[model samples]
Target: MAFTCTIPAVATLQQDDEAIRITRWDFEPGAVTGWHSHGWPYFVVMLVDGTLRIHDGEKATDVPLVQGQAYMRQAGIQHDVMNGSPHPIAFIEIEVKQPAALKQLAA
Candidate 1:
């Protein structure tokens, strides 16, 4: 089932290239990102100290966030994200689209 929301968060594309795509997301309390999946592995750096409510297909999980802290997830992750905090929340998402050759070169 596709996740839908009444109010969605703001997602700004900061950068997009062959190897990566970066987005800055801002959300008011109760705002959602809707249901989605990433084609590449991604990392997220939380911009504020707050909690995010994530629906991971089966259940909803409220996760705590710390400013400047980062977390990563593999590709094909599907979920809906919501700002559970009373205050506004922001974060930077980095999607790695590195090709096999590029990944080998970096290794």
Candidate 2:
């Protein structure tokens, strides 16, 4: 489904050892992140409960995440994350980073 992104609250949770970076973002129902690409391998931990649909090119996945559940993702992936449920969704996005030089090059 087509959507427009609504600005949401974003906060950096942590960044450690060039191995991982975590951030939290909040979204209301019908909110979308628009098309974007992940720079590093990552994972997401569902914070506030909600349903989300992640679409990537020709494929799509409906993932229902509860508080504390986690999902892993990879770099170079382009996708749109949407909050399809009625309640707002809050989650922590963790990016697994490469070495300094590698990450700088990717950046």
Model 1 per-residue lDDT at 71: 93
The per-model lDDT (C-alpha) reads: 0.88, 0.74
lDDT of 1 at 70: 96
Model 2, span 20-103: residue lDDT tens? 677887787777777778989888888877888777766667788789999887688888888877888888887878645344
Per-residue C-alpha lDDT of model 1 across residues 1-107, encoded as one tens digit per residue: 43455588999999999888899999999899999888999999998898989998888899998999999999999999989899999999999898552544444
How much does each candidate deviate from the true structure in C-alpha RMSD?
2.3, 6.0
| Candidate achieving the largest lDDT | 1
Stretches off by above 4 angstroms in model 2 are 1-19, 99-107
Weakest 10 consecutive residues of candidate 1 by summed lDDT: 98-107
RMSD (Cα, Å) of candidate 2? 6.0
